[model samples]
Target: MLHFLPAPLRGLIGATLLALNTLACCVPLFSVTLLKICLPFPAAQRLCRWLMDFIHEAWISCNKVWMNLLGNTQWQVEGLQGLDYQHSYLVTSNHQSWVDILVLQYLLNRRVRPLKFFLKQELIWVPVIGLCWWALGFPFMKRYSKAYLAKHPEKKGKDLQTTRRTCAKFSQTSVGIFNFLEGTRHTPAKHAAQQSPFKHLLKPKAGGIAFVLDAMGEQLHSIVNVTIHYPQGNPGFWDILSGNVDEVVVRFKELPIPAEFIGRNYDQDEAYRLQFQQWVNQLWLEKDAELSELKQRFPGH
Candidate 1:
């Protein structure tokens, strides 16, 4: 183990290895992606997807090696039972740090289908990683502000159209669709600015997930509600890379999607929209309480 190395050296080595891993995997991944694109047949697309998923999993496994070599962080995880890889899930989490991505990637890799986050439409242009995301079938959303929507009256109801059109691509495969309910990482400054109701979380944005359910409600098997905690305080990506993070805790619960939510239009139906937001609020309440319990369990958080 290189855990004995200095933090700077560990971080440097980790970053280098991660870059190399991504570059190496992207080579084959891009090739398969090209093949998938050039040939639009269902069988060809399926083959390419399988190849890409394997490459992605390999990339994640390489990260595991480097992390194990660098840090001895303790892990406390629960509620990971009865997960099926063949099933699709709408995964939601409390966002805190960039490391949360790696944690989830590490924790649920093969336990469920590989995760594909709902990304912004602009992210599809983000160099090599962007292409990879596109190849992997991550849905890109074109979100419009209320004012913008009002200015362009024609754009109204198009959000649902975009969501449904993008989500239609997922119907053929079982992939984990992830959304950070808070929409951004939580921070003390942000908490104070927003006057957050929860001590630890920012306000949960209900619209994104609501749109997701409205589109893929039939395809998704269930909602996988995940709560991640950093007992040593939320670490920056660099902190994790440098082996400064001492311990991590994460909880996973498979929540059944409410039957009423299925086949419901979140934007068109006012009643469904209100009821869905309430459901999300209650879920957030439980997640906040769990964070509190975890904080107490670890002490000095």
Candidate 2:
């Protein structure tokens, strides 16, 4: 890609493309905000759904346009079969790069409603993207630190309750809740800092999933557990655009929501919590092993 264009020119062009895409994304966001203010609650909800679909469509278009402009990189997706668009799913995956978001979006766009991520409260302040996420019905959450909780005992379960209420009110017209079990993108330094127990990812964060399961357990029909492998290793956005990235293998396994797990106490019940943690850790172990094998086979990818 741009093997003909000098490195400086290629970088400049990529920057221009990013700017253009950002500008284009703002149109739908502004439109949705205005519609929400003007319409009735029920009408506004329908409009929001349409707006999210439109935004995702535009995002896919942007990805295709940019990749084509830089080079003709082939994109591959698989394992989408019998995915009911009318059912609610909890999507869990390993986090590696920002690119992970796009890969998931591209694969599951029409397959399900665009994913509603559980975001940190402060992300609400991020420029355009923040506002769009809010308008699209993503729940912004605030986690209390242990020290803060100790100081203000009254505030102990407040955040979790707030999250539960917010998420419980979320529209149930078929959607995916995406969670990065590792909590953050994977990097050698960060992984070392955490002294992770697994080879491929940081330790699983149970609190986040626990909150989600507690809040939306009755509505959740299945778990869309995805395993993503970037054959060589994780790649930056530029690596993807420059055709330096090789294969991205994705495996999808749907797990049924257990009857016993529904609406169970995640915090007070130590035994149940331990059992849930063990199940999540087993998933990470299998993912780590799969990624290791893929890396070995595509050593230079």
Candidate 3:
């Protein structure tokens, strides 16, 4: 096994495996695109679904290979079975490192239609990856600043309209909408600057989740509240591959879709919006407590 190799040698092997993983994923991706464009309706859909399955399988295989070869980072996922592919879901997770994305892809893939993320409208032009994301049905949002909204008051609800239109197009399939409610990666400095009420997370941005709920709440079955912990430390991507990380613990808790949350106007109804914000605030509080306990157990770098 590569685990017994010298540390430097192990890192080389890890890098090699990562390269192979990327190369391996491309073949199926290209094949799916070709089939999607050339094939008929149900046939194309079937082929695309198969490609998604292949990608998810490759992801697992690559993660397993990298972890075993490097032997420093380990992953533990709880409540993975809580995800239901048959129903729509809004998955919220606390952001920490780029590793969070990989961890998400590892856990949520196949079970959840490839985990569509909300992106800024500009990300639609990031070359091949951007095109792939669009093809896979990720939502691109145009966020307006408060200052701009005040100047052009009529434009206030336009973003929500855009979101609703985009999400409405997928009539038949259930999708997993993933958002990091903290809005950015968590850091001690960001936490302090934001003066967050929660001890562990930065301030939660309710607008994103509220918009999704407003646009697609009827189809949404549950909210997947996920908490991720880095026991060794929050490491960068290279740190993970170089056998520097200790372990990652991820927890998922599925909460039912509240009746009041459905069909609410998140932009216009202050009372409904406040009620939703409070609901998210309570989840962050529980996550804060969990993070505290986890920090005590894991400590940090």
Most TM-score-accurate candidate: 1
- TM-score of candidate 2 versus the correct structure, residues matched by position: 0.88
Rank order (by TM-score, best first): 1, 2, 3
Clash pairs of candidate 2? none
Which candidate, 1 or 2, would have the higher TM-score against the true structure? 1
Clashing residue pairs in candidate 3, if any?
Answer: none
RMSD of each: 1.4, 2.5, 2.8
lDDT per model, in order?
0.88, 0.76, 0.78
Task: State residue 13's C-alpha deviation in candidate 3, in Å.
Answer: 4.2
Worst ten in a row by lDDT for model 1: 157-166
TM-score of each: 0.96, 0.88, 0.86
Q: Write the per-residue lDDT of candidate 2 for residues 1-301, one digit (tens) a residue.
A: 4646654565567667866786688787778777777876886777676776678667766865665566544444456797887788889898999878877876787787678887888999998778877777788877788998899888877767876876766645666888888888999999999999888888888767777788888788888888777766787877755645556777788888767677777878899899888888888898888778756755543
> Candidate 2: worst 10 consecutive residues by lDDT?
70-79
Query: Model 1, which residues run further than 4 Å from truth?
Result: none
Q: Which model scores highest in lDDT?
A: 1
